[model samples]
Structures are given as structure tokens and as C-alpha cells.
Target: MPQANVDFSLKETAPNIGGGRVSGSEKLTSSFDLVEQMHFFYVRVVRVRDLPRTRNPFVEVNIGNYKGTTKYFKMDHDPEWNQVFAFAKERIQAVTVEVTVRSKETINDEVVGKLAFDIADVPTRVPPDSPLAPQWYSLEDESGRKGGRGELMLAMWMGTQADEVFPDAWHSDAATVSGESIANTRSKVYISPRLWYLRVNIIQAQDLVPISRNRNPQVYVQAMLGNMVLRSRFSPDKNINPTWNEDLMFLVAEPFDDPLILSVVDKLGNNKEHSLGMCTIHLSKVEKRLLPIPVCANWYNLEKVAQDNQNNMEVKFASRLHLRVCLDGGYHVLDESIYYSSDFRATSKLLWPPTIGVLELGILNATGLLPMKSKDGRGTTDAYCVAKYGPKWVRTRTIVDSFAPKWNEQYTWEVYDPYTVITIGVFDNCHLQEGSDAGGSKDPRIGKVRIRLSTLNADRIYTHSYPLIVLQPNGVKKMGEIQLAVRFTCSSTWNLFQSYTHPLFPQMHYLLPLSVYQVESLRHQATQTLSLRLSRAEPPLRREVVEYMLDVGSNIWSLRRGRANLERLLATCNLLVEAWKWFDHICKWKNPISTMVVHFVYMIFVLFPNLILPLVFLMCIVYGASQYRKRPRHPAHMDTKLSLIDSAHSDELDEEFDTFPTSKNGEVLKKRYDRLRSIAGRMMTIIGDLATQAERLNSMLSWRDPRATPMFLAFCILASIGFYFIPWRLFALGVGFFAMRHPKFRISIPSLPQNFFRRLPARTESMI
Candidate 1:
């Protein structure tokens, strides 16, 4: 099979090409040190030359330890094998691209020749636009002897850092901003460094240097840490003692290399700004004090930018800024609350008392979704859900050709602050075809809901459907509703701490410490098992039972369980349940509106077939243009106060409809409880009836029944072929004509096959 090759080139000014070989002891020592500063090396194998003629020749190429083979070519001397491999910089330091030629034989493959080249000689860095071109290299034999008469064309280059490669829009603070420019971000390929949040409160400035003798200084503070910069609001008309009590936060990488620079600048009348004095706070000092908690607020004197001995004496006593700063060690850059400006700390203290708990969130399913119009005029949606809690984010699989998608996925996240909110967003997956206009492309957001952990009662399971609300340019719209089950299990503070600090536990302190590949692998395995267990069980497992199994199976209870425990967990799940759910969902009829709209379109097509295509094409063009014009040109950050107020309003609505009795009248409360119980019993009866019908249908369609299996297969084949050739309008018309009529007419029309084939001999009788 042909493999995709990534091309890279080496610079002429490569480093240390002729360095002496290190001893095994030295190599081992340096290897550990080099691991910390590891970078990605992309090695591309382009082609091979001067190979000996063979019946079927193929070349196996190895970079570092990973190996790949080329397609075997019949009687070919020179074979092309374009393949790329990525390795860590530490491993590539003494890496060799080893190529071995082999001939395919009837009994066993025979080795024709072998050669290797050291890739350590390649340069580390190059300009982004100008990459090194592919070049031919002489291959060497096993003993470092130059006897092989073969050459390999190879190219290699260093991969750029994520921050440098991704566009600014990706890192922007706006959620609604179009991510078309983020196409090449490749965030999955790189792991972000551990990050910390630095909160700075600009309390006030006491006695600052005046810009002029008569004019009052409009002083504002600017805090800088590397590339991140934040500015405080200006203190107008407060020259002598400016007071602007504003808070600002900066997301910084761990091992904090740079000092936080705070500069007081005066706004001039010409719209220009002039710096008065500046102070530097080394993050190293902050790190030392953040062991237990951040350091207390203190007044620090600011140093003069340009010292004049005579003027400095006059300003020395007054040049100081009263600031309160602290390092928030637990924050992850990606998990910084979208509504961080909101006062969550104050709200937490007001709403719920302090408690320690783990929040178990089950994203069960979503229903009543609004179908998006596809290119072919079919109402369809590819829906997926993204749930984020603190630093962790979990994305469920995309359910294609579905309106009511049942994910039945569960995730758990540690909750340090009960006040913090978890945001779950459902979106329509839009694939952009090649050569399409980027600005015109749109990925429709179905809806999003945020839930605060503090609002829920501890140890109580709350499973309910929350309406998926969306805000469009016109107004707020009800997209659908998502069914979620959330339970917070309270644990003692000491126990929680012990679990976190356990020696055998994998590092859960950092947000998602596992690599992307590892996380993906675990999720895939778990999903497969869960799906399997749901299917084969005689009685379907309860949602609570499934969740409990998942919690145990996922190794979230304790990381020390390792691989054996995970495999055991996987074995307990049934796959058939998942398959059945999907099949049933797809086969069911859509909503009333969807059915009406589809039939209406079909009627138009049947009446005027030629005009239907032209009308659809024109509508698409108009819609795309309108969407392009409506796209936000600038990023807009969430309004914290508005978000909080909206959440409070939602809470009020929930309380109004809550089933629990809030009144003291025993008779009234008893009546309410009786009514609710009756409704629940009726719902259970309906569900049981539906299940019975489903089982009857399943048995009739089962392949285990010899009489039914052949008939079902024959019907399926005939239906598939008929649907392929028939126009959708004609199908819709035929179905509508029969559906609108009485059952007496429908039953009399389908007895032809049974009557005509009654005399046919059975397969068993023919064998006899």
C-alpha cells in the first residue's frame, strides 16, 4: 500500500555532523537529560535507487525504532516508497534511517541489501517558509562500512510549537467566533504545557510622579508577562492618589520563567500614553510563597524609569502602588471559566456550604432536535456533544443521520470549587469540502447548557431533561432538550486528599495528564465494551446500573487498578443494546414538522420536476451569502453579569416546577404525590408495552429462525434495489396514499405473495 510522505530538507549549516561517537555510559546519561527538551522530528522517505533486480522487490525503512515497508513492485530495480515518520528530538539525536531491500519468495522473503544513515547531522531549526529540500544520501552497511551500492532520497525537518503554528482566533476568548481559520491548528497533535492563573488586583496608587505641574494624571496600570498583556481601567482626575480597584488575570506556563511587569502609564491629551514608573515581580518568588496559599497583599514602591537625582528625591516618597496579587495554582489555561469575571466565590458562599464531592455526569441522550437542511433538501443533522468541567473535556461520538441521538456516555471530574459551572454544548458537524469559501462555511450550534455543582444536593441523583436553548439573531429558540443524570457523591476532606496524593495513583493533579493517544485508546475500548454489554443482556440494564459499571470500569475510582482492571470492566458491557438503539432511532418517523415539510417538497418536485433542482440551487446560494454576511467580524467575550443573571432566572424556573412539596398543607401535598405516582405508573406501562412489541419484531427478524431469515433477507434486497431506482417523490406519494386511507383497505392489498407461493415446497422437504 502507498503511504503519504511528509517531505523535509536539511540545511547546509547543520550542527555537529562530525562529532565523535559517545560511549554507552555517556549516551545513557545524556539521554535522560535530553528528554526534557524534546522536540518533534518529521522524517520523510521519498524513494530508493540502485537496487538489484528481483522478482518482487520491496524496501523496509526504519527511523529510530519505528519501521514501515513499501509496496512490492515486480522486477523493479528502483522502488518509490514515500512515507513519513515522527520521532522525539532526543531519540533522533543519534537516529538512523535504515533501509533494507527484500524479495518476495514463495516460501519466505529473502533479504537483498541493507543500508543506514545517521540523521543527527540534520539541522534543528529553519525558517517557516523555506524548508530544506529532499536530497539523496549514500546508504551504509551494518559495520559502518561504505560497501552498499544503494541510495535513498530522504528529507527531515523540526515541527513548530503549537502556539507559533495556530492562529490567534483559536486562542481568542470568544466562544461564538468563527473557527474557519483554525483549520490547521492541529491542537490534537501537541500537548499544552501545565498552566497557572495569576490574579492581580490593582487596589490603588499612592503618590505618583505627575506628568505635568498643573494637569491631573489619568493613570492606568498595565501588567505584562511574556506575550500576555492586560490593562486596567484609567483613574481619571486622580493624579495625586489614583484609585482603580480592578482585577486582571494572566494565564502563564509553569516553571514561570519571566517576571510580571506592572507599569503605571498616564494618558496624555493627544491620545498618546506616557509611562510614569514600573515594578517587576519575579514569578520565582511567587512560586515559593504559593506552597500553602498565595502571599498576602502588600504595598510595593515603584522605581523611576529615568532617574534625575534632583527630581527623584521629590518623587521618591510618593511613588508607590498598593497592589494585591496571588497565584491561583489549580487553574488550567483551557479551563479558565468563560464567565470568570462573575463573582463565583461570593455566590458559592451564599448558596451552599463548603463540601467535598466528585460530580458524576451522565450524558444519556438528546431528543426533539431541529433538523438542519442539507444540500439535497433532506432534513438531517450530525449531532455531537461536548462537555467540559474544570480542566477536563469529553466529546461524545457524532451520531449521523439522527435527530434523537442516544449517546449514553458518562464522565466524572473532580470538583474543587462547587461554585464553578460545567458547560455542555451540542453542535451540528459540518464538513467543508475542498475549494469551498471559508467565510461562507458554517457549523450550526444547536444549543448549550451550563450547570453549577453548588445547585445540586449531595448524594442525590437528579436525572431530568433540560431544554436546549439557543440565541439566534432573531431571538431565542428552543432547539431541543438533552437528558442528563448528575449525582454528587460527598467524601471526607481527608479521604479526598489521600486519594489525590496517593503514590501509586497516576498524576491526576494536572488537567488530563494522559497523552491524546492514550485518552483516545481508553475511550475507544470502553465504548466498545459498553456497547456490547448493553446489547446481549436479557433484560436491558438500568441507566443507574450502567453508570455504576462505567464508574468502576473507567478506573476513575482509583488509577492504580491499571490495564487488567480496565479489561475486566470492558468485558462487562453488551454491544447489542447500542446497535439496537441506533437502528430503532433511524427507522422511526421524524417529528410532525419534518414529515410535513418533506412531503410538501416532494409534492413540489412531483408537480414540477425540472424546476426543483434549480430552486434548491438558488436557495442554497442565497442562504450561504446571508450566513457569510451575518458572521461575526470581531470576537465578543461573554458578559459575566448577564450570564449569572440568566442562570439565576433559570434556577427560579426550575424551582417553580419542582415536584417536591414546598408547602406545609399535608392534604394538598398528599394529593400531589398521588397524582405524580399515577402518572409514573402509566408511563411505565407504556414503556413495557413498547418493549414487548419491539421484542416480537426482533424475534421475527432474527437470523436464528430458519423460516424467517431467508424471507427477511429477500425482502431487504428487493427493498434496497427498489429504493435505489425509485424517485423520492414517488416513494413519498405511495406511502402517503396508503397511510391516509383506512386499515381495511391496507390489509386487503398485501396478500398476493402468500396466496401465490403457498404451494411451493419447503427447502427441508426438498432435501428429504
Candidate 2:
């Protein structure tokens, strides 16, 4: 036999940070620690074979405080996992990495075999170099002595981020997620199924047979598609042939297999209904409409119900119902609200538009955050951020026990439309158990921010600190502020503009539009699918985080939101009201010279009708030029009033945060119900007021008022005769000159038309 050759490598001495002298062993240990900090050490558990009669065999890796287990294989002598586990060298406290094979079929998870590799024995490999080839090692006992008749094949190496499996490898950073949630920490791809809009336009029904002719049978069409059922308003004719020009829509996905069922029912007293006829329409055979053109209505023969008894069988009459059904592909099926929706791709792949730009968001850090939960009587927070855009979502690593955490992570997405928005929400991570000081199970929201891509200028970066305000039951609380840097870079200006010219949704939508509720329901499905997919990624974002960030409960009943929306409407109306006031002031001739000048300008425009549009456009240009200095100097931020957080009632705020299905006691619910009725009363009054105004205009011809209808008809007939002979310019001149007449000539009382319309009878006075 050849003589055994022994080789030794030189050990370099690592100088102490204090420049003090150290022993040889100390120097060697310091050198290893220094090396560990700069590199990553990992093992690829590849395969195992030749097991000697073991049941439910599995492999578990042990490294210091960390333990990872592979999936178990039953009734098999050989198993392949091909999993990778990476350790941050600086965090590893052990000198050796152990790989143990066990039989889980036993209650104690019986140890079948084991292998140990000293940390120093692990080889160093970098990318550009071939992957470390795995070799078979004999199974041994804890004493390093061969005991089991099996072999394991795996590779051990040190590498950087450039490693082939680096992105997918299980890392120590995410080990705190717990072994049970391992699947949520891996990378995955989820594809959403293409969906379309199914529209069922219920037209008039012919040859209808009523159950009772004396009752003037009230008829309505009830359509059932899947679990959803919608009923059209009762027909007004109430005859054998009822006309109902109503349309019912639904959201349907591809591979259309469901059938649409239509039932013609007659409403009777005592909460009873009688079916006149029924028909079934197959979605696969429905027409496909892409454009806004009208769909051709076809009459389908409705089958009458046949009742069979033990003694006799009775056959009912047949009827025909006019209907128009089609699958609309022209519209984009919204699975989320447009305000913060990331995905805008058409329901059908064929109708998907082209990309326009790239959106990059940098999650820098947060500051001045209040502690979310208490630990050992002291408040603390573990904060993280989740950003979603289009089909891609990114979650930053949690910064534990921090008040001001810095993430500084950047993510990018391909933008298809500038009008789309990206949502970023900061949340407290209360689920982490390892080294967790703050104790809480629910991840409370810090705040959320939404930025529309269209608002961002191309190639310009917007960096701002957005305030996070959370509305609690007691009041609105200032959570903290997050700093973010966002940039939207357009690839080509031409392409961006081209996207605007294209249809907002696919052409199929216009041909067969879906109802608002259908779109909302489908949006929930899309979000569920997205949540399932995103949970599979490395360091998965929890479902609560996803729901909170996406604002799945935003539509929940909120008195605060109602107030905010009402304020918005008032603000919009205020502008027009203010404009009217200004006009009234001018007409009052408060400034005689200005009013006279207005009258002159108005007369000129009336006399020269061709110059009217030019003068109006010129005024607009002048107004825009004058307001240039008052333009916004900075980007808009969240407003307490706009969000309705400031001055919100405690009860309203409580209801906003109330759990779905209501977890409150009966007494609390009763109080809430009373408050809700009060608020609804105001809304009802406003609605009634608006309806009265609209009805007054209709009553001029409706003959609801004994005197108003005939007077209005006589006035219209005389006006028509005058308009037929008089030129349009003459009419304009007469109206303008008369309205702009001097204050001395004007009357202080209300106009005759206003008084006449207000006095007209309205349906409101008859209501109880």
C-alpha cells in the first residue's frame, strides 16, 4: 500500500480590535467568526436510498438553535426531497451541521440514522463555478460509527446571492415564521382565470296567462344565474302581455358550463308567488358582444309547469318571452376598486393591452410610530410594509421591537396603464414568536397610502412622508408616518398615449355589461386567489395583512365614510352655488359699471352668435392664466376632513371598526340601530328633496296640478309659434338683455317660473 500523505494548511492570525496580543487558538477562532459574517453557508438535502424497513421516513437538519425537517415519505425505501437550507454564518453557534434521518411512523419520531459534517470541513463555492456535486455518505449513529444500512446524497457549500437556488432557498431570516408556515415562505406563481360578463336583458313577454284575472296579476321577471338571483321591477301594464325593458347582468368565468334560468312570476297578496312560465338559456350558446351596439332580442318559448299527481296529470299553457343574452368581453372585470386596484388587464388574454411604463417604489423607513402593543408593561412595535401593484406584491422584512425601523427595500412593476394605482400599507407584525417581546396576535394597521401612477411625472421621483391616521372607536389616532420614494418611468410617450385611445375595458363588456354587484363579487374572488398565491412566496404576507392593505372591508358600513362622501358632494355643489351667488351679485348691479359692461358683452355675443364660442373660450384661457400662481406647489397629502377622521362621533367611529356579522350585544346594537335610523332619516330627506325638484319639472306636463299643466302647455305652444318665425339670435338677445337689465328695473321678489314650479304637487306630501 502507498504511504499515507498528510497535508496541513497555515492558519492566519487575526489581530484584536483593540490591537492587544492574543493566543493562537483565539486568533483562529476570531478569523472564523470574521469569515462567517461575510459569507453564507448552506446544505442541499438531495436524496436518500436503501433504507432498511423504515416507515414514514424523513430527514431533519439540526444547526445550533435552528431545526428544519423534510416532507415524509411512506412505504418507500428511497425518497428524494431536493430541498435547500441556508444559514447566516454569523448567527450559527455550532461548529458542526448535523443531518438526521428518522421514522415518523413511530410516536417518538424514532431516529433511523444520522450524519455530521464539521463546519470547517464544508467547502466554499461561488457562482460561475459549477454547483457542488453531491456524494453518498454512509449512515452512522450519534457516535460517528456506521450503524444503519442506508446512504444519503447531499451537497454542502458556501455561496453568495448569485447561487442558482439563492432566491428560492429557505433562509434563517424567515425561520422565525415557524416550520408550520414553511409553505408561505417559498416562491410561487398564481394565474387568474379569464372571466367575462354575461348580460341577460329581459324584454317584454307575450301571451302570458295569469293565475287570477280579477287581481290584475302583477308580473316580474326573476333571473337565476349560479347562486345569484335578481328580480326586475313589476310590469306596469299587468295585462296578458307585459312589457319589462329591464336588463340583468352577471360575472362568468371561462369554460362556461352554467345555465341561466329565467322565471316569470306573478306577485299575489299574503307574500305568495305564482310562476307563469320558465325558460333555460345556455351561456355557451349566448352571443358575444364587444362593442356598445345593441344586442338583438330573440323570443324564447317558455315551458309551462306540468303538475303530476297519483290520480291525474295536468299540462299548463305555453308562453313566449323576449330576451337578449350575450357574453360581454369588452369590459375589464374589476376584482378590486379602481382607486387602488393594481391589475387592469382585460378579462380575456386576447384583449389585454400593452405595457406603458415601469413603476418603482422604495420603502425607505418610518418614524414617530406609537407602540402597537405592550410587552412587560412597556410599549413596543414590530413593523413591516406590504406593497401591491398589478399582479406582483412585495413584503418587507419585519423590523422587531422597533419604533423607527428602516427597510430601504425597492421593488419594481411593469405598468400597463397610467390611470392605475398602487397601494402601500404599513402594519405591525405581532405573529413572530422567536425573540418576540411585544405580545399580540392581531397585526394592527399603522396606516395606508395610495398613489396613482398618472399623478406621477415621468422620470421624476416623489419622496414624501405620509401620515398614518387610524380611526379607532374612541377617536382618530395618529399611528405614525412612513417615508416613501416613488417613480414612474415611461418606456415610450407614444405608447402611453396610445393606451389612452384604446377601450377602457375589452369590447365584450360594452356588448354585455355586468352589473355593479357582480363586478364587486368577482373582485372578491380575484382577491382570494391573489391572497392564496401571495401566501406561497418567501416570507408570506399573512391573510390579515393582505386584507387590511387591500381594504377588503372598506365598503363596510361606516358613518364616517358616509359623512365624508356627503361632504364631497356638498363641496362640489358649493362651487356651483358660489358661482350662482357671484352671478346674482353681478345681476344685482352692486357695481353698476361692471354690470353695464356685462350687459354690453352679453348683447354683443347675442347679436354676433358666431363669436359667442370664441369669447367663452377666451374667458376660460384668461381665467386659467390668472390662476397659474395659485396652482398647487406640493403634492396633495391625506386630509383629516377628507377622510372624516377629525371630529367623528365616538359611536360612528365604533361602528366603523365593528366586526362583520356584528359581535356587539343586543343593547349596543339597538343603540347603533337608532343612530343609524337618525342618519338615514337625514339622507332620506335629502333624497326626497332632490326627487321633489325633479318631479316638479315633470309635473309641468304630468297634469298633477290642476292649474300648472294647462298654463305650461299654453306657454309652450305660444313659445313654439314665436320660435318658428323669430331667429335664434333674436331669442338669445331678448333673454340676455332682459336678464342683465339694471337693478332699478329688476324686481326683488322670486321669479314666476320658480314660484309656479315650487307650488306644483309632489308625491312626498302624500307619503306617511
Best candidate according to lDDT: 2
RMSD of each: 30.3, 17.2
Model 2 TM-score (2 dp)? 0.63
> Please, what are the lDDT tens digits per residue for candidate 2 over residues 444-479?
898877765654556655556776766566776667
Write the residue-wise lDDT of candidate 1 on 1-768 in tens digits: 001231111111111111223221122112111111225565566777875555677666566455555567777678786654444444443457666767785456776666665676656653345545689876555455554547778776665221132221121111111224223211221112344556688888887877786888888999987755779988864667888877776655545677999999998878898888888898767632223243567787887755586766444434888887876543222222122211112111222223456776656678888887574678877666766554344555455567887555556765654434566667765532343334444456776655544334455445556666553333335677776656566576454322222221111213224343334333333333333444233222222222321222221111112222232223222336675665455446446665566678789878866545455544444543444444321111122222222223433333223443433358977677556644554453344334333433442333222223334445455564565567667877998997798866654222434321221111110000
Q: Give the whole-model CA lDDT for all candidates, comma-separated.
A: 0.49, 0.67
How does candidate 2 score on lDDT? 0.67
**Cα lDDT for residue 549, candidate 1:** 19
Show how many residue pairs clash in every candidate, following the order shown: 11, 11
Q: For model 2, what is the alpha-carbon lDDT of residue 303?
A: 79
